[model samples]
Target: MTSELPPLPDTPPPAPTEPPAVSAHVPPAPAARRLSPLAAGLIGLATGAAIVGGTWAITANSGPDAPATFTLKGSFALTDSVVPDGNGGCGGTRGYDDILEGAGVTVYGASGDVIATGGLGNSTYDGDTYDCTFKVAVPDVPKGERFYKVEVSHRGTVQLSGKEAENGDFGASLG
Candidate 1:
């Protein structure tokens, strides 16, 4: 059997076509990689120098009574395994040769004289808790609540100990 084919329809009119648009705007710049080694080193050196210079400047120009009494308080664990004197003696056969545990207090006197000093043995008394209070008085002071710093040191000797102390105020205040 032969199959009959359908006739094609009449062609419709063509639609309009527009031209592509163009612009003259500049492109954005590409991002840069990490800084060069030389640049990084210079920056690091500059930062270190600035820190050192600032520290020196501050220390050199402190006024009288700038830092007063440095009060240190903290608990220290004895490494010797021997208890404390229970009488603030900080007793040990070692004769307290080592700081074992200590609190550092930095004080400044009037006249722009800065002093770094600290205290020792701030811990419990005979197994009982104790508040170690160490005061490094700054001489020739004008008078006011002065600023101070506290540091603790643990001995590397036979004694395995630790200590703690806190200032009445922050580094900017007395205590």
Candidate 2:
């Protein structure tokens, strides 16, 4: 036997469409104001001048805080095959402490406790040329790692102390 079912409903109708409207009271958009060529050029020149002036000020205004002072002099004679000390140097041959007086020189840790003490000596090169000797013996410098400093007192005062490599080498740090 077949059972009866209800019938389907019809689709709804479409709605009406209309064009968008504008308001007569609203004003039109304004154009951007353009700068004159002369004005633009002057502005660019001023900007460039400002940048250059800033750069000049920065470069020219560098202050006077310089790094530490150190100097070393020695005979590089191959025949005088004097290698450096335990720190890769050796020189009782010829070296200057400080041409200027009060030039302080200090050597830190080395092998023994005996730090470097400075003094004057004399050396004879391959020829009969005599050389001035400035020596320093470190009294308590550590063996493997060491540090030293050589400072000059202002502009005068000669330093007769720093006569060894551990004393000073342009502020070099030894390992």
Candidate 3:
């Protein structure tokens, strides 16, 4: 008894599906555009400059008007019969040793608050006038007060109008 094989169908089996072909030469991801070292440095510098400029502008315009200030200038004249040593000070003349030199000068606000302090400069003696004159300058004294009080050494405080303080033509006299 011979076994018979089944008859093959006429329609051919469906063709095998294939995966799409991949390109081997994919263009390297566009070389990331790189900045030159000089360009990078310039950009960094510009950014830093912009930040600094912005900060400066904010600070320069934000604060109260620099507390309007003026140099309180004045002079002290001491009338004495003692002859000067021709130097800036008395220098042992008549038992006086530069009494005006380095003397404390104080500025007081309207509220009696101490505003500024300075020392008297050297004294110059005038032969004809018999006056030992010295100059004192209290720099950067705040303005806008109705009045100011100025005192030299232990001398009493002298009240001055705003205009007088601004003009800076006030002083103390001692004999």
Say which prediction, candidate 2 or candidate 3, comes out ahead on lDDT.
3
Best by lDDT: 3
TM-score on alpha carbons, each prediction: 0.24, 0.25, 0.59
Give residue 29's error in model 2 in angstroms. 4.1
Q: Per-residue lDDT for 2-56 in model 2, tens only?
A: 6977766687665766766766687777988999999999999999999999998
How many clashing residue pairs are found in candidate 3? 0
Off by over 4 Å in 3: 1-18, 21-61, 81-83, 88-98
Pairs that collide in candidate 3 are none
- What's the TM for model 3? 0.59
Per-prediction tally of clashes: 10, 30, 0
lDDT of 1 by residue, 133-167 (tens): 32232223223423332333333211111121222
Candidate 1, position 129, lDDT:
40
What Cα-based lDDT does every candidate model obtain?
Answer: 0.42, 0.38, 0.80
Give the per-residue lDDT digits (tens) of candidate 3, residues 27-133: 77776788999999999999999999999998987887667889898887777654576664542235344455787889999999998888787778777777788
By TM-score, the candidates rank as 3, 2, 1
